[model samples]
Target chain A: MRASLKSFTPLILFLGLVVLLAFGLKTDPRKVPSPLVGKPAPRFSLPALQDPNRTVSNADLAGKLSLVNVWASWCVSCRAEHAELMRLSREEEDLQILGLNWKDDVVAATRMLRVYGDPYRVSAFDPDNQVGIHWGVYGAPETFVVDFEGTIRYKHIGPIDRTVWEQDLLPLIQAIRKTTNGHE
Target chain B: MNTNPAAPLVSVICEIFNRILIPIAPLRAILLTALLAVSTASAYTLEAFAFEDPAQAAAFRELIEELRCLVCQNESLAGSQAELAQDLREEVYRRFRAGEGRDEIVDFLVARYGDFVLYDPPLKPSTYLLWFGPFLLITVSTFFLIRTLLHKRQSPDSALSPREHEQLRELLDPHGSDRDGRNGPDQDKSDRER
Candidate 1:
């Protein structure tokens, strides 16, 4: 037993180190798990990006499955994710894409929307990022999947491509829908 | 003096110094002063947040210094120039001004950003590996180390027997066994003569 244990020690340590290093290499350091998941979405009322007279708030996200996409005109990833957002908006009629125009110039945000078809149901203008602070928004191109009851179910950091929408977001949305339907 | 190898080199170096270095000394000083001024101008300036007391200001500084900036992973909330870091600083300042203590402020940040915001992570089930993994590694390695050392100490191959010692001595000094055992003092004199 002692001889066997001695022989296995180097092999065990080598395998363990390989596993640890591979895991580290595969994982993205920037993708931090948000504590906001499973909690109610933070409340905020801000002026609409396009029409300053109109307002969008947490109340707007109520009684519907909403994808609160935190984006900005200055963010490159936001532009990258625009087509996906537009496609999602088109496909999922029930899914409301509530935009949080985080820390961006209003004119530029409006121009961006006009140029690349507006995917948002109603975009909230947050110039000073007061609402963003409450939402724990560190970077742009973050999307929060809020359930019908306004509880945040999932948060996707970085640009959302077609694969991400199908693989991660769709399954979660379907699961939430099934549960909600069963309860009702 | 002419025979000295470095004489020509030294005179040439002196000539170059007189022709170049002395003329550029004032210019180098001016250039150095400009560089110093640029560095001083670009030094970090803390955002002016009004505080009721000096104690509150110190606490606020300490709080931000501990909080990690999410945008720039390595920078603290106090040091990062990222807009998100600025927003976070403002949030901390707001909470501080409202008379909330350090724990409460940290808790609030953790609630939103998760434990990643804090420089010092709390002792929890999730963080057990992060906190104690190094010590556990040291302990395991030390156990193996001590075992190897003890094993080495007990190994018979390392210790020489009487016969092996004699053989080694003969091999090292070929004439020692043939020479007089009492005449060992004269061995060195014989060696010198040879």
Candidate 2:
């Protein structure tokens, strides 16, 4: 009984430590809840990267299908999902792609644009994240597809991969473009 | 066709009661559901509870936010609607409104409940790990973190200096002493420190 009692002590302590470690450690996702779904996209008029005079807002792209991709140069997932954005540009002529860059300096974002083949028609800068917060974004690399009427149709979190493009994103664009939303 | 004043009067009264009472019942039900939903949206209080005064009720709500619902170890009392959290919130409110000072309330809880009552406890030698473990763990992890990350470092010796590692380890085990390592002191120092 004494020997068995001695052997059981180590197992108990090991189990105890494992429980303590698991309970103590806390991980933060640093993500915001998706708020734009089933609502109108927040309106903004940001100057285009190259064409400083040309400002794009929610109103400018009304009555046309637009894809707004929220990304940052620092986001690893954005790098992972860049190729798919390029693919979307190739396949869909009517689906205009816009980049809403969050918290990224011009130089780094410009570098990312160069590397990723600039699928964005125009990239907007969100320094100090005021625009991002107004849009209610936590971390970057989120995507929203707005219909011609300025109502948001879909939100894609993380990267725009092949499966999502086929399953959800493509179907939404095909349906929204059919709506009577043509702005000359 | 013979007109009857008595029959017409009875029918008019029936119609009047239906118009008033039937609509009001549905309206009351709708209002009741709306109130429940709004209350449920902040459902971290867990249980149906009440305080003696408005002040105790408000403070209890804040205190619950700080406490970890034991059932949902990751969630605070304010963030969880678990039954245990509900019961705990009620307990906290009961004590707070009863004119107990903060320390007395907490001590009574600690005496019966153990160290899980407070979200952040005092930093004694015994609870040093609990209070400072996050920072220490982050620091030690930072060193190993830097090493794993900086395999591209200029010098191998620059893989977090020994002093840095010791400090990191000390931080990780906030309640640790030289005599006993890792978890709060073993039997020898547990008595002395705790």
Candidate 3:
């Protein structure tokens, strides 16, 4: 037993080291939940693509139902998503679709607008992509639906489709609109 | 008009020769410095997929980090984060791009470096114990701990020595079986008490 106790201490410590290593390996970053919900819209300003003198700011979005779609010409999926944006702008009432062209060249973004026909109220060019990073725009063509009350209500990470609009988008707008009217 | 180019050349050569000699360690250091400078400018070329899709990039990261580097031992390609591990990860991505299945990738790795690469070694005849080693270790340890404790409680040799017995006797009685062997009067009393 005397000899056993001497060896057992090291053995127990070695086992502990194994457990520590297992815990260490599991310690990578987990998914982050978005904090944008219930908070006021993040203030931003960008140069309008078509008209350089006319800039769009968060203040411009006051008292309206609007969507801020982050897109770029270089992004392949943005081409696939052109028509849906036009359809939303055409069909929806009091729903303004604004474009945020992130990390794009002026010429390319302009060409994209010309090719696809601009669906936005006015597209803004964010050359340095600072705004995209702030919005957690990890990819091109992400959409955020901002309410008239200046709160970002919804986020779409990829291309928005009919299924997403029918299932997620339309319901969200109706609910927010209904709740706000009750206050009146 | 007394200008010989060789005369000036000889003086310059002498100055250079004076500065050129060094201890062996310093010479070795100079050589190593030159080697490092050469390598600094050497460009290493490699190809890796730059995914525009964040989902794909996330998936790629998961696969690279989780998968063990076959060429290296006992290191996850992600955790080691070595150049060889990076190369292996790039290879895995290439295979992923080619639409190779997971089994095909694993097979490729196992072919290159056998079971030593795997952290969770498979349970076959050869590695049956390796796969089950931890549980077996815990079981053996538990058995030994209980056995050691029980042995201490029950073993006859674990009892107090003769010297301890004498000390106990002295403690129990002030005059313990001494002085003219008359039992010290209290000796029998003490024994009876014990």
Candidate that would win on lDDT:
1
Instruction: Order the candidate numbers by lDDT, best to worst.
Output: 1, 3, 2
Candidate 1, superposed: residue stretches over 4 Å from native: A1-5, B1-44, B158-194
B126: Cα error in model 3, Å: 44
Estimate, for each residue in A1-184, the C-alpha lDDT of model 3 and write its tens digit: 9989987988998999999899978853221224465567677888898889998889778998888888888888788888888898899968999899887888989988898788899887887655654564545677888888988897766778888788989999999889888977
The candidate, 1 or 3, that scores higher on TM-score is 1
The lowest-lDDT stretch of 10 consecutive residues in candidate 1 chain B is B176-185
TM-score of chain A of each: 0.96, 0.75, 0.79
**Local accuracy of candidate 2 as per-residue lDDT tens digits, A1-184:** 9989978977998899999788666532322235466678776877766566777677666766888888888889988888999988888888888888877777888888886689887887765554554454545588888887777777776788999888978877776655444423
Alpha-carbon lDDT, every model: 0.91, 0.71, 0.73
- Give residue B166's error in model 2 in angstroms: 74
Q: Which one is best on DockQ?
A: 1
Task: Indicate the docking level reached by candidate 1.
Answer: medium
Chain B vs. true chain B: TM-score per candidate: 0.59, 0.42, 0.50
Candidate 1 residue lDDT tens string, B1-194: 49999999999999999999999999999999999999877554674777868888888998899999998999999998777888888888888888899999999899999999999999999999999999999999999899989988888466788999987887798676565464565766897899
Model 3 CAPRI quality: incorrect
Error of 2 at B70 (Å): 22
